[model samples]
Target: MPRFPRLTAAATAALALGLLAAAPATSDEPLVTEARVSAHFDLAAGQTPENIALDGDGSADLTFALARQVAHVTADGATSIRATLPAVAHPATPIVTSAAVTGIARAHDGTLYVNYATGTSATGVWRLPPDGGAPEQIAALPADGLPNGLALDEARGMLYVADSVRGTVWRVPRAGGTAAVWATGAALAPLPAPPAYGFGANGIKLRRDAVWVSNTDRGTLLRIPVLQDGSAGPAETRANGLDGVDDFAFPGHGRSVLAALNSGSRVVLVRADGTVTTVLTEADGLSHPTAVAVRGRTVYVPSAALSTQRDPNLVLARLRHFISRG
Candidate 1:
């Protein structure tokens, strides 16, 4: 059976206060009306959609976290296979028991980079050309690490990854160089569980000189500054005690983020001041929603469905009065 650890005491408190540490930007009115959005796409049974990347034309390419395939999703929810990851190349490690593609990001030139954990020791970041050519292995991560969320800092020529197992963030050069550990903190470690899920920092986003990351097990959103020397500064919590926080997107530019609650089967809008509003829930038709992507006012989510014992699928929701700063 699929397992989702219950929220710890800290997380429970945050949820009670609507997942905010400061007053909201405006009135207590909900950010987006619940009924204004609808499903934008669906996936095949057993297709575990994990992360999504928006293309130049507004289409989204999705990566299956527990599968070896990538899918191209159109604006209307149409999907097609884009690539199939090859089998594990290196010897296996006990750290990463599952071999799957966990995260994906697209470059401005239309190229795609994907992180594959064939095993802990066999994990690597592969790059695919815009023309769908053979994938090129760019950088191999540590044998004890598990790479998950991905974000690109084009100006810095760096691609950042969240190592869920190691509880650290790594910086990989876009032009192919050795990957280096960029930042880490206590907040990135998973909390105690009867059966551990091996999840910590799950989602990462870059805005200006700061990078934001979400801890799945700890239910916290943290921000780390990128210094003048391109090194990471101390990590600070922006919000805590979130519920089932998995992957998130900055829909209101840097003003707010839309997060997917994998275990709760809901999506929430979190403001700059830490105000949170439930944008969609299971009652709104989501089922174990794992990740989210934003393009303009539209938010896309992939429901893994394992928690709800249903087939995995993709759903879309639109905001009524939301404005994106991106």
Candidate 2:
């Protein structure tokens, strides 16, 4: 098991204090982009990138939301196919019988974890080996539930999954076992009425001893503590008012996070104390930015461009200049 290093207690406290003393974010004083590091590179026409996971060597593994394929993008902007899913069925009852792979997580040893559902069968969590072999089913969820986000607590040998339809966060062992509901609160539930996005907990990440999740339709961020007994504590709000919070990334070792404002078509910096900073907006060239992956100084953003497919591409930004060590 492997764990991402976290900010020291003192450093995290300092960031919270800094955010408390800073002024609120506004359009007129937005956080500007430091630099664009990667050249825009579009995928094959008709393909849309969904989730992203760092491959430990500065490269990233990407999932296609429409195509049945997974791809790898290098630091220089080159892309290559890694895996593809077989044709799946559709049940007559549900409007949607199948969903493309929408979430991906890479283990310390390079294995990839993907989330997808096919018709009325139980949703399968497939594991892809690093050496390029057929994917194997490691875990399964209810046929009606939709798993949207995945987070690996490598140090604890646990995999945390966000079930968008069920409005629950499930905890499953990495080595395969029964998955149980680990955390659930009002924040994880979907909007009360129809015409809603039908999304609840959309993004999940494990940092230190806490597991964080985002509510897409509600635009809220919540987290729960992982107790010594390997059980989850109560969920608490970390931030709110994000119009379309999606997948996010924690850069370096700080408490601040970069979250993709999907419907807002922007990426915003969320400080420790809930202060928000508009990092990149539509004016800076973004179209439905869906997921963010941070590794060292580079922040990788995969824009779905569902409406503006003509310019669909991945954007990498240099961030050392804008991020504060505290």
Candidate 3:
């Protein structure tokens, strides 16, 4: 996660007025309508949602980063805590400054997988069985590294984790065992720290036989092919100039995606050809949106409010359609 300074009262007021909108969308940009906050979270209680996983019935599983809890939100906006990660005695996490639960993925069997970065030995991937037992650490990741993104390949019984600090992707067995570095390269490494704290691979998703990752420091989206033998192929840039991009989701069965620009407080639709379209912004109730998930035409975006410290929430929007430019 990238750290951002809090907005001044004047700046916040301007943003609320839509005077400081993120790069305005062109006529050719994708149209997102009926954008509204579906669920409001408590900023003081640390209910800021960092990432989301959608269930079959329109419910959502969310990782409340600062709260260190995994919660459920129903289609009608009802929210409840599903599980809470164990608290650390002396918290000392890298970059973000606190122990947190980040990315999440739900399995076909109703199992839930999530990443926790505690800067302690307990930092790793955890599993919450559908039977409602206590969540347990399944794989151990580097205590110094920030595991921010997680994706499950259910058919292959594998889990892919994006380590923001280590600049690597680790592969862990679905049954809980030793983890292995699946891929690493310059494309995944964080930018040299004159800025002091920068994240490398922040978000990840498995789709269309490839693993897509977002590099926050590099401000780019990358795609690494899954070779026939299940090895990672060369990494290629899909889109760039997405400064502050944290997490993203494919809205349709297409190459285009809606990405969360955390620092920019906006969500942009990146087309197949890499053309970027500003769709949702701070005016639409996004308080530094951290991740996106879509089910049919319904889009779910969770805001962490790391900078805003205001209304951290889950916003729902309708993906109307992309405007075709002739």
TM-score per candidate, chains pooled: 0.85, 0.84, 0.90
Best candidate, TM-score-wise? 3
Residue-level lDDT tens digits of model 1 in 1-326:
01243456543222110112333446666555443223233333336677888886777888865556788977666778898777664535323344667778899899999887655545768888999998787999976666888888899899999887778899999987799989987888765553666678878889779988889878888889999999999998887767778888876545578888876788887777787778888776677877888776566777766456455777766665554431
**Which ranges of candidate 2 are over 4 A from the true structure?**
1-46, 91-97, 307-310, 322-326
lDDT of 3 at 115: 94
Report the number of the highest-lDDT candidate: 3
> Candidate 3, which segments miss by more than 4 Å at Cα?
2-30, 322-326
Backbone clashes in model 3, listed as residue pairs: none
Residue 22: error of model 3 in Å?
28
In candidate 2, which residue pairs get closer than 3 Å at backbone N, Cα or C atoms, i.e. clash?
Answer: none
Q: Which regions in candidate 1 have their CA more than 4 angstroms from the true location?
A: 1-30, 33-45, 89-96, 193-196, 323-326
Over the stretch 1-326, how does candidate 2's per-residue lDDT look in tens digits? 00001236643222111112233335465344454535354534435677889887898888775565688988887888898865555531122233556688999899998876554453657788999998777888777776778898888888899877678898878887677889877779877535565678888898789988888878888878899998888888889998778889886465678898876678988888999878887766676777888776677888766544435567887663344432
Sort every candidate by lDDT, greatest first: 3, 1, 2
**Local distance difference test, per candidate?**
0.72, 0.72, 0.85
Per-candidate clashes come to 2, 0, 0
Model 1 global lDDT (CA atoms, 0 to 1): 0.72
